[model samples]
Target: MTQPLLSERTLLEIAEHEGLVLKAYKDSVGVLTWGFGVTDVSGHKVGRYDTANGGSRSSIERAVEVFEWLLRTKYLPQVIAAFRGRALTEAQLTAALSFHWNTGAIGQADWVQSFLLGRRERAWSEFMNWSKPKEIISRRKAERALFFDGRWSGDGVVMIYDRVNPKEPRNPVWSTGREIDIKDEVRAALRKAGSAR
Candidate 1:
């Protein structure tokens, strides 16, 4: 039998998917204050903070809360299921997932999904070549360089609670982890995922 592709869920799990936890206690509103540990703005956090200082009906929740919510309510489960039956690496899936998650297309990024499903790596190249404002946070030049080269990467996108991202909100990411022959993992999780759905 052909090997299976690694499931996105498995990729996250292997990386110890604890969702987002706070690096330190934030303010009260969950809109991100101005302090944090090593993590940057896109960096995930688990504590509270002033999210918007008052805006729309969207409640000011913690960075971690939003991160987890996005992971769940945003259709991450479906994406993970797709990865289960494809020839993708954990890092590739994570990179794309985390990238879209940080951006606002958590469940609506069609190009990303289609590219991955179609196994078109070249088509995915330009994903990192977006405007800096589009990127969630930090080290713009460096981030662009690494993402395009397919080698080297940062700690990925982080959800900094109550803090702005350092380095000017560039793309935060590291080398797609070891490229694994994911066929096996994909096959295994596909049946299981579909059944649950």
Candidate 2:
């Protein structure tokens, strides 16, 4: 059987939530991040000093590149493995990917077990267990809606947050007054990524 691939909608939704940060900045709870919530790429952890040496910004195109690479190299494998051998609906796979990308706990999440055991209602409820940090509750709801009802929310635009002080405590980086429709870009990336896989 052919391995399933992520739809463009999933990519857009994830991007919309993560937002686009071309420059490395501290995220909520203060981790060095850039390019749509990326903390690290391959083995290179994002560092505080890295920003000073021309690491300040990335283009939207480069952000898409990093996002696609991470999806292919890191996140997708974890999702596929967590599901064991069971088939997943596109919606289920998308929801799982978004949740795992944010939380990195898919392999041990109770919702995965609840889903596999056919306790879907319980699965939906338990999925909310990851809603710490509190800011992610809406995202959790959106993921659950996608998983259970196949509802796709969010406009296709990825908002660009302003660059923040690397030394300051975490604050909401205001939108840099820029947004991009990454729908086509994501679709193209997904096609190439799927082929490369």
Candidate 3:
């Protein structure tokens, strides 16, 4: 059977998980990023706030467009290739994409390799290792839930740390607990953004 492409729901879930950023900013590692964690497109790299040569600000529409394009052309293929013979649910694929968007190394990630090798429990434990800055922990939890349970909740998008409270946790229960309804939130956010086509 041919593998399925990411469904609209999966794409929206990823966008919701990533959140929308209209302006380019330096991420945790100081890489210029924007539009759902995109680093570069075509040939031009995104701009950094501290640099005199920052990338131009983007509109919501443009940002969404670029995000979708990059996922289709870059990240998705890497994921598809990684799981070439395995069948994955939409949620699982979305989880992998989200992880890839965050770390850009999912193709080589030990968790992914473990999953591919059929060590599912090992893969799940590996997810937690990505945890940091609360947001990443939350995101990793959510992604792990999606990978294992196909469920998520507590803010559609994962919250990143700002300078004020880099260590402060938000919605701590989400990291340890399970809830539902995030699919609804993802759908709602996509509808509101007018990107749910």
Cα lDDT tens digits for candidate 3, 111-180: 8888888898998898887776676787788889988898844344433322211122211122332322
Better of 1 and 3 by TM-score: 3
Regions more than 4 Å wrong, model 3: 1-3, 41-44, 48-55, 154-197
Model 1, residue 35: what's the lDDT? 21
Give the Å shift of residue 43 in candidate 1: 17
Write down the lDDT of every candidate, Cα atoms only. 0.36, 0.77, 0.62
Maximum-lDDT candidate: 2
lDDT of 3 at 35: 56
Clashing pairs in 3: 47-55
lDDT of 1 by residue, 53-162 (tens): 32222222333233333444443554555445554444454454445444434345544555656645643454544435533333333333333344334332333222
Worst 10 residues of 2 by lDDT: 41-50
If scored against the real structure, what TM-score would every candidate get?
0.37, 0.87, 0.70
- Give me the displacement of residue 9 in model 3, in angstroms: 1.7
Model 3 lowest lDDT segment of ten = 164-173
| Model 1 lDDT-worst window of ten | 170-179
The better candidate by TM-score, 1 or 2, is: 2
